[model samples]
Target: MNITSHHGDDQVRIALTGELDMATTEQLRAHLDHTLISRPRLVLVDLDGVTFCDSTGISALVAARTAAAAAGSHLQVVNAHGITAKTMQITGVLEFLTTPPGH
Candidate 1:
């Protein structure tokens, strides 16, 4: 997976591409671990380019959100569709991570 992040308005927007599986989950985990240290107000994970997602990937998202909340930051997943969205839905992760900002 290719993970890139941008910082703006006291938030970090992380963009992800490629497959999100066990092979690439560590990279995301490490990236998120590093980002959470700064305690940004918002941490957005954009899965616009992600072509696939597995259980491990879903777990990482949950863990990241948990860590972010513990760090006093808000974490949300956005732009997830296609197979990735289907996988998240199948695993019941869509409800956990895909909530919009206000609701």
Candidate 2:
């Protein structure tokens, strides 16, 4: 998977494209690690372009949210549709990640 990021005033947005599996989970993790170092108020991961996601990918996402929380920041999984959405739902993180900030 290809991961790109944009640093905003209050939020850091990471966009993912292609499949997110074992082969690509590390890439996402690295990006999240790097991004979290900056301690942005919020991290928004855009999964609209992600075509597939396996358990590893789901774990990476959960890890990201955990990291953000530890840093006193927030992580939001955005535009999760199709298989990606279903995967997040099954993994039991979609609701937490999609919930509005401060909710």
Candidate 3:
């Protein structure tokens, strides 16, 4: 998958296109790591262009979420649909990662 990022004062938005599978998970993770270095208050991942997502991709998302939390930040997936949305929903990961622990 291809990834691009946009940074603002308190938020960073990462946009992903193509397939988010094993072959692209590392790239995604790398992008997340780089984005986290800035310590934005929120990290928004835009999955509108994501056509597919495998288990590894899902794992990567969760890992990013954990990393953000540990860094005292937040992460959210936006514009997810089709296979990307379905995979997350069926795996119970959509709510798991989107919903904060206390909420």
TM-score per model over all chains: 0.95, 0.95, 0.93
lDDT over C-alpha atoms for residue 63 of model 2 = 85
Per-candidate Cα lDDT values, in order, are 0.93, 0.90, 0.89
Which segments of model 2 are wrong by more than 4 Å? none
Sliding window of 10 residues with minimal summed lDDT for model 2? 92-101
- Candidate number with greatest lDDT: 1
- On a 0 to 1 TM-score scale, where does candidate 1 land against the true structure? 0.95
TM-score quality measure for candidate 3:
0.93
- Clashes in each model (backbone N, CA, C under 3 Å)? 0, 0, 0
Give residue 84's lDDT in candidate 3 (0 to 100): 84
lDDT of 1 at 4: 95
lDDT of 2: 0.90
Residue 27 lDDT (model 3)? 92
TM-score of structure candidate 2: 0.95
Candidate 3 ranges with C-alpha deviation above 4 Å: 100-103
Minimum summed lDDT over a 10-residue window in model 3 is located at: 94-103
Top-down lDDT ranking? 1, 2, 3
